[model samples]
Target: MPSGPWKNLSADFCGPLPTGEYLFVVIDEYSRFPVVEIVKSTSANETIPIVDKLISIFGLPKVIKTDNGSPFNSHAFKEFAENTGFHHRRITPRWPKTNSQAESFNKPMMKAVLAARIERRNWQQEPFKFFRQYRGTPHPSTGFAPFSLLFNRETRTKLPQVPTYKPNAVDECARQNDEVAKRKMKQNATFNNSPNDIHCGDVVLMKNEQKNNKLAPNLDPKPYNVVAKKGGMVTVSSTSGMEKNVTRNTSCFKRIPNTLAPGSVEPEVAEGEELILERKDEQVPISDSKSMPMQNAAPTLAPETIPKSKPTVQFSDKRTTPASNVTEPYITRSGRIVRKPAVF
Candidate 1:
């Protein structure tokens, strides 16, 4: 949880709406309060103004988390972050769970738009009404309304209520509720953890998520060496001597068994030294093989033990014309052209 309201924020672009406008959404990590701006574009210029306006109303946030979209990755956004004195952090590509606050809000926000369209109401105006109700309602995790958590006052709504002013009590209650909710979520999710056998330095094959064909293996054919393991995330480096290094959730990698031990380095062979292979119960030196007698060699298989070879069938040469005066081309019923092999 954030230290205070507006300290940590998550921002995301929702869509090209019915009017072709995108919703720039900003969510407060602590309060879960959202501020959305329907804009013509999601460029850095448009995003900066919406965030700047929000910063003026609420204090400047310490950190703003967003996906690696063009707006967030642009030089203009970087400059804005530097000027505003906030760290602009980006979530992992293709992973939206890192920015859970904004992503979670987007579902309901879109649902409100859809609901409005079905009811024959203005879609644009319906989101503001939805936000009002959402802000006033008590959150499941926090057990306090977003408006109350952010402003330390109860929001006015259609429902009748007695005005209560206890900012300290609200904060304490929200903190306890948040902790309890997080604990329950973690307990339920612990079963999906990475395999215990996977460890640092183990050889692993990553999941092939972008396979082009059904015949492709589920895991990548190329093996990678695990360099680091942190909780559910694993860092792997390419073992094929390529400069590929990636960090992904542990579930993405499949461990290889009966391979080299972790942190164990193979002894390097000296230049011009041939690699030696030793067979069980037979200690033979490959370099000294020429000196060994033929009598010491393993016995050849008995005639009966060897399988008999099939008789070879000879084909007539193409140059040798057929005995009959038939002038038909050689062709199979399936339309395949057939020709007799020429005798050398």
Candidate 2:
């Protein structure tokens, strides 16, 4: 947990708005003090400067949390993190709640923008106004205004108030209240109690984060094989070579039945080929010459096939006739008659 404001920070992008601008929001994890920047793009080049400006104001944060977005996952962002001397912690893919601070702030910021859009006011100006109001107001979790927590002083807002002496118990009170709120939140979330059932070697389906249509299913239909598992993190390799291997939280995966064949594609039959279906209960005798493959058939085997050596000598097709004194003949499951020889 973050011990104080600016120790830990979280960031996320809000949009490509009507004006084709994106709101790049960064918030101090402890104080919930947000710094909003209207970026032309969410590229690492654009975002890194904004983050550097914030660092200039608040000093470098120990850790910066973000989602597995392209900007954050890029090599440039990685180099930026190394150069800036801050740990860049990316949250689980497909799970927004992991970066709750930035995600929660995005809601009210969007609502403010929507309000401005409806009222025919400047959308960009309204979100900053909303941020000012949010900073002055008391946060529900910590019971302290974001400005007060960040600066350790009373924030002057539109509402008139007598300037009073700042209390020294602010940090202690915020910590206690934040801990209680977190405990309550944990208790209320039922998923916190659910066990991680996914494991290495399990065949699974990932939660599809990028759905092109509303009709798309929540979980991807393509199967993946769990190549590794470390605590809650799972490394899955796509069974169908279409996608690259991805490492994500176990919650992003749904364990499928082991019977499923990963990346398996059914072979297409050629123009003159016949499709043969076999049943488990039906037994074809090896001695039946008609059931044998054509002598001149291709020697190459399918990937799943296990080759067996041919017999050195072939058996005769001729069968011995049953004696007339034989009592009775036994019938097998496949309706083949078995004649027993008379006892000496």
Candidate 3:
């Protein structure tokens, strides 16, 4: 049975890679081989031609799967696929498991592309070289190069190798068969975890901690729909309806409830076209009565005058006549003063 993951190329190149930009990728579920093509755009008009060419080269796959993105789910692409008789399967709304093959391929391709751009500063032409190296290298699990698997033959390359004696034919055949069985078992396990098992319209929290941490608090905790689930991961879409891959564990995140303090009042939104306060038109009546002005009356006072003193006795004029006849005061034994008669 041809049951395995396959690459689904979506024509809607709405990313910021520039107008008319596009990315074409190929995936092999069993080998996990991925090939990417960068184009100008993913528009149906532009994509049809590319798809035709790829199909012609790779042959038609049983089912072509993709995310529920616009380009992949566009009416035009659907019509085109119907006409071509190819099954067009879309992954659940926000789920990515339906197209995990292509999505997984993008990771390494993006990393390599980024590294190339960093080293060369001109990465536009580096994809081809990287693709060639990747396809040529032997896969760790398959032990077969993608080029060899796709072409069914080993490509010639000049490389040094130690000469070794050939093993018995039977031994080599057994070894080869054992390797194939191991690869098949791994592929089976991968398909068992297909994302399609997730139910439609499931509410899932997306792991956006990295991107959200860089955003403002008001912009955080983006919600998404669980469009698909595969293994431990789920594909989620933002409220704006963009899909992204997220781990199932992260889909459990819930919006924190808006809470208020027990005694606090929540503010209400004010309504009404315009608010105008009622004001009285009349001016306040003021009393005109005035207290009588203090009169600037002059002070009344009496004039100051000096008092006359009486004259002392004139003893100096009569001193010449009274020198010899002047009476003298005498003190008696009892200490009393007495006046003596003239003794000239």
Query: Which structure among the candidates has the greatest lDDT?
Result: 2
Tens digits of per-residue lDDT for model 2, 248-304: 988899998866656565454455443342334533233323333444432222233
Better of 1 and 3 by lDDT: 1
> Which residue window of length 10 is worst by lDDT in model 2?
298-307
Q: What are the per-residue Cα lDDT tens digits for candidate 3 across 1-344?
A: 13443333332222345333557775665545565667776666766677777778776666666666656768898998988777877768866655665765666666766787679655667777677777778977678887766655554556664554356897799999999999999899677744333444554333344553555353234555556656555555665656555555423443332232123355532442222212244122212212111244222111221113321233656553323444434334543334445434
State candidate 3's TM-score. Answer: 0.41
Give Cα-based local distance difference scores for all models: 0.79, 0.80, 0.55
Candidate 3 ranges with C-alpha deviation above 4 Å: 1-15, 18-20, 158-344
Model 2, position 61: C-alpha lDDT score: 90
Report the lDDT tens digits of candidate 1 across residue range 1-344: 98898899999999987778998899999999999888999888888888889999998999999999998999999998999899999999999999999999999999999999999999889889999999999999899999999988899888898977655886899999999999989887776664467898789888998889989889877778899989888999987668768999888988886354344464554554533433344222333333322433432222342325422334566353323332322434443333344333
lDDT of 1: 0.79
* Candidate 1 residue pairs in clash (backbone atoms < 3 Å): none
Error of 1 at 9 (Å): 0.2
Error of 2 at 146 (Å): 0.6
